[model samples]
Target: MARSYQDVLAGARERIPEIQVSELAELLESEDAPLVIDVREQDEWDEGHIPDARHVPRGFLESRIAGIADELDAPIVINCAGGARSLLAGVSLDEMGFRNVKSLAGGFSRWKQDGHDYTVPSTLTPDQRARYSRHVRIPEVGEEGQLKLLDSKVLLIGAGGLGSPSAYYLAAAGVGTIGLVDDDVVDASNLQRQIIHSNDRVGALKAESARQTIEGLNPDVSVKVHPFRVDQTNVLELMNEYDLVVDGADNFPTRYLLNDAALMTRTPLVHASILRFEGHASVFHPYEGPCYRCLFPEPPPPDMAPACGEAGVLGVLCGVMGSIQANEAIKMLLGMGDTLAGRLLIYDALSMSFNELRIRRDPECPACSDGAKLEFRDYEAWCAGERGHAEAPVSA
Candidate 1:
């Protein structure tokens, strides 16, 4: 099969990527940033480097990139004691066709002489002042975002692996309210990844047990237990009251149902799922952002993926994925930072790697496209061919 443009580029960059410092700094200052990469080795970085710059030595760059969270394909500025190595790095990256990259002028020496700010261990410290203390320092996530995360409400549509860590982080982040919708009872099998609920909570209402666990983590958080399975009947009502919705469902029916309902209400849906060692996550909204239907256009079959109940998942992978989902919610609520609106984040937990794909709004999408009717329609029956699946082929 012929590779699409994205697949070809994804293949090329998967092998090699480039860097640009000045452009990196500007990007950090732009809507895309907060990134300043230090390509020097540990000892070289110790001499001097930009504050908060991620240090990934040139020698280890190829081998170590897979472990860096949210680091894939982002613009990076390389620096060394001098600009020599960074120039080579930049050129190499450019050869690999990395878009929007450059090298810092004069490396650390110039940044220091110019008084641009350098720190030790490349670690951001709290005493550095709240404004520049890591998250707040980025234009993307400012004080406004920190506060939004504190007061935001999010509902997780499941209580198994995905919901486990999604709920945990939401509570820990001080989210004002977290609604758990699940009709299943906790079971010993869940303890492997559903860390919030313990062995004792088994046989208990999964929703209620999830709530109790959140209360234990931070009593300030208000957790509402909705012991009913969310479907077309009440998904809108349950999700309407929350600021954000995290779809951790394991089946296509509920996922499509949630997508249709969220589209009708103009609510943002953080969609995610785990199968074996792979997972995909993204934010979908019909009114303001790319709807889930835009990405899939059509839902997968009911048995496309055997339920997680049958196919096992990597326990820790759920935590990693769910934490990222919570992070997106925080970024969205505070109205700061880049939420995954037009991007799809795919992860391979076994190798600890991730890839971000461009998500374009389908101008012909039935939900949010320019000519879209934006009506509440039955997704299951639609996906089930009730109205005849191929009747209206997605108008590209």
Candidate 2:
């Protein structure tokens, strides 16, 4: 005989340990807060859930648990829209060898009904309120959303053509912290497209020059400069320090490294590349969307690709694509409209037209798949003969 939903839920509750919503609220207030996981669908989560709750929908819990939590012995609390689903999830976690797991009794509804506080963005200060008044006026980026942008951190990989425009716009938009990584010195030739650098700063370090420019544009922004090339040794740690990474690197080696590093840390990467009058931009969010490796599993043959210095690029192309990158980053920080997460936007200045193509995550992606493990490798060695094909270093 088939059992009803109630019978199934009753059986699940019998095997799982549960904590009252009121008690959980008290525990949350204490210093030792348990790791709370919300097993609701995205829509349900968006409506309202616990503050700082790790969202692992019931359907994807089994696949995502290990990535989210390494210490199986830590106190873990699971919840859903109602008490029933949470009990079921608790049972599953217990079976998965997770220790000290508890289901939240009555779930979020009960917590809300019991007068327990829910999550909301903190209030902005008077100065911040005034500074972001225009952004606040926009419905999508109201006071709350503007606060999110102010709290966001974005790291840029290069201070050349792409990074120049992107950094300027992001700083102007009030991104709280901007990290720049570039080891080259500005040259006279860079003035054509690398607008952030001035002719007087020809020998100045790219990262430092960009920092000074951004600081001048917006004193509220904090610019951190990594005055060295990003390699396997420092790439992972550097990327971890920021909330998001913008790939404005001019070469395939750095691009590939950033892609792999972003996947390993599960950080979102906003990537763009330009050559001649054509430019390409996309967002790579590991697991949730396709990664750079998913699109280009391997770099092109050394002789097949030409660098910007060799093939030449239109200065305006950088502005167009880099500005789009900034647009995506702002939208991501504000949690606003759709991003180019799973789509590639291609721009052609000659035709004066834009086109888009969808990108899909590779189940066997060498860098991002759950079963795959990728470590940092010598990108320079891999791109040995392709040095000329890399994005050209900008001259001031």
Candidate 3:
């Protein structure tokens, strides 16, 4: 039967029950709050909408509703600028076998006129939309996840080999702030693996050189250069400032110090160590998974664990490990995917092989165990065998 728009809206209203704006507002605050779906256009939604409302848009309602609402019997409330569109949307949901569906009688306009609380969403500008178009297209890391990345702050313990690739990729991915802690200056020899530095920048402070490189790559990222070594005195203060730490220190003292500080500050640590023809990577989420101390109760003897400078490392190995660290850091920030929290990843370039080892948190861990007292110790002395040691774990 041919019908006018009014006739169709009248039929929808007859089929779908409508709840008044005042009633809906009270329902939102209740324990049994319904899933609020805003069927407004993009511009309308950006201006303002009900707090905790999920935007499905009237056009995509039928197609995308299932993903947002898992169960057919779940309570749902549809809303739009006025009441007509919400009524129509409720009819569609009803036809789709949704048992509990209601329309907001006066929609967002009435809700706002009634002095109800609303939220104006933060939207990306045109430049940001185009800049992170690739990331926005991803289902797991859409606009919401990208915004989280843009608001995050990460700390890198070195501006050398591993820090170079991690910082570069993180900046390109739109990480808002990156803090580089390095007292060393760039040297010509570091160019082979430390891609963030150039031959012309030799003798420049590593943190400053890396900051310049990151700024050039992505103007959206702010780089904070800390031209000082991280020690017990300043490690906690530094860790407390960032959301997560990427451990790229090549020396045992710095690595151990970062591990302890990370635990004390309850910061997630993305750790990677590159040696000749090999690399190791893992994430240490405080109290959630095994920590660095849990993996290695004691630092290996100086003779057994040689620095890359003393033992030489493959130039490409740093890129692989550092990139992994960045990946882990992003996952942690987004709170998505299974991170390497309880696992150790070992990569061997010579054999072209990858291996994983499960890491269980030590109940008696000196740093992360239940009721364990976390305090900074003389990491340099401990690593150099000046302090008492225990049998180190066998795996990397």
Q: Which predicted model would earn the best lDDT?
A: 3
Candidate 2 local lDDT, residue 2: 100
lDDT of 2 by residue, 141-168 (tens): 6555776887899999999999999999
Candidate 3 on 1-396: residue-level lDDT in tens? 899999999999999999999888888889999999999987899899999998877997898786678899999999999988999999999999998999998899999999999999888787888999898766567677898999999999999999999999999999999999999999899999999999889999999999999999999999999999998678888889999999999899898878888887899999999899999999998888999999998788799999999999999999999999999999989999999999999999999999999999999998788877777677766788866442231111
Pairs in clash, predicted candidate 3: none
For candidate 1, lDDT tens digit of each residue in 280-332?
99999666778887888776655665777787888888988888888887777
Question: Scored by CA lDDT, what does every candidate get?
Answer: 0.72, 0.86, 0.90
TM-score of each candidate?
0.62, 0.67, 0.87
Each prediction's RMSD over C-alphas, in Å, is: 14.0, 13.3, 4.1
Clashing pairs in 1: 18-93, 20-101, 20-102, 21-102, 21-103, 28-34, 140-337
TM-score of 3: 0.87
Q: Which stretches in model 3 have alpha-carbon errors above 4 Å?
A: 1-4, 7-17, 59-67, 87-101, 349-354, 388-396
